[model samples]
Target: MASSSAATRELQKELEGKANDLSKIQKDISKNHQVRKKYTIQLGENELVLKELDLLSEDANVYKLIGPVLVKQDLAEANANVRKRIEYISAELKRLDSTLQDMEEKQNSKKEAIYKLQQRIQSLQAGKAKA
Candidate 1:
């Protein structure tokens, strides 16, 4: 219906102030504005483009009618990728914490051993003085 690129110009013009009902319009402007030429064109005096609000999620708002195609995507796959990254980072942090704990225990033991040895040497010196 609104497939003609010409209507895109009209739609853009009309959608300017109606942002209350169209919350995703800001994102569309950011994501689609760059490739506007590739996706949009002038049909007579009207300019329009078929936009897939989100190619990766397709949780989209059809703003302009491009050529006759609706781009739908697999959101599950994207979500999986994010989850994997988070898990990897969390594991790495846990490993670092363990290593730090081990180092701290080793340092504590060394200090304690030095203190005990010093006490033994002091007692031996006092006995030699008495002799």
Candidate 2:
């Protein structure tokens, strides 16, 4: 009975540890989702800026907002900057997508492990009761 109790305690401890790890992973996933959302918004805004720049005449005045100040900028320069920003954001989104996929996979495996641990604990308890 003592041995059984010890085994049960060990299993319970392991389960708790796994639960903590799962929780941390879930939090990380949530943070990743938020970051990805922000980047997506930025990408959309940059694309819109690019489109507007395209519609403007070659000699159209362009100004960049710099900390509540509008600084004059060349139209070509503005277009290039916006395009670069869009490219960067798109790449970051792809990287985030890959990371998200990996995290989700890890999360799923952790969930499965936790479920198996619960089952094991239940079985152990049931066996102890029978004994």
Candidate 3:
């Protein structure tokens, strides 16, 4: 028969390790979320800039100060940049979600293992009492 104390200690260690790993995963998710948020803000700012430029075009004085704009690609590039930022944010969010799901599954598996160990220890004690 296995030493019950040793088994319990080993199981505890395993659980602790899994908890640490879960913590790391959570931290990674947080970092990813922050990154996504940063990109979102940048996208918003770009859109705002586009809006301001559109407004400026309506004002004769502003257009004169800016002179005849030769940069026809600014709008297109801004749109493309915003699109790229959105895609990056979406991908990062998806990655973080998947990572969280995987970590949750791992945590559940460890908990199941701990439960089984508890049941086995109980059964061993019961058998010893019966003997």
Scored by TM-score, the top model is 2
Worst 10 residues of 2 by lDDT: 40-49
Q: Summarize candidate 2's per-residue lDDT along 1-131 as a digit string, tens digits.
A: 99988999999999999999999999999999999999999999998999999999999999999999999999999999999999999999999999999999999999999999999999999999999
Model 1 per-residue lDDT tens digits across residues 1-131:
22333444444444442433233433444443443333222221121111221233456333322379654334554345445554554555455456545545554554455455455545545555565
Worst 10 residues of 1 by lDDT: 44-53
lDDT, residue 42, candidate 3:
67
Q: TM-scores, in order shown? A: 0.36, 0.97, 0.51
- Candidate RMSDs in order: 32.4, 0.7, 6.7
lDDT of 2 at 72: 99
The whole-model lDDT of each prediction reads 0.42, 0.95, 0.61
Kindly provide the TM-score of model 2 when superposed on the true structure, using C-alpha atoms: 0.97
Better of 1 and 3 by lDDT: 3
Residue 71 error, candidate 3, Å? 11
Q: Number of the top candidate by lDDT?
A: 2
Give me the displacement of residue 52 in model 2, in angstroms.
0.3
Q: After superposition, how far is residue 8 of candidate 2 from its true place, in Å?
A: 0.7
lDDT of 3 by residue, 12-127 (tens): 67656766765675676577568767766765775675566555543233211136553334544544555676567667667766876776677667667656766766676676
How much is the lDDT of residue 32 in candidate 1? 39
- Cα deviation of 52, candidate 1, in Å: 19
Output the lDDT of residue 78, model 3. 48
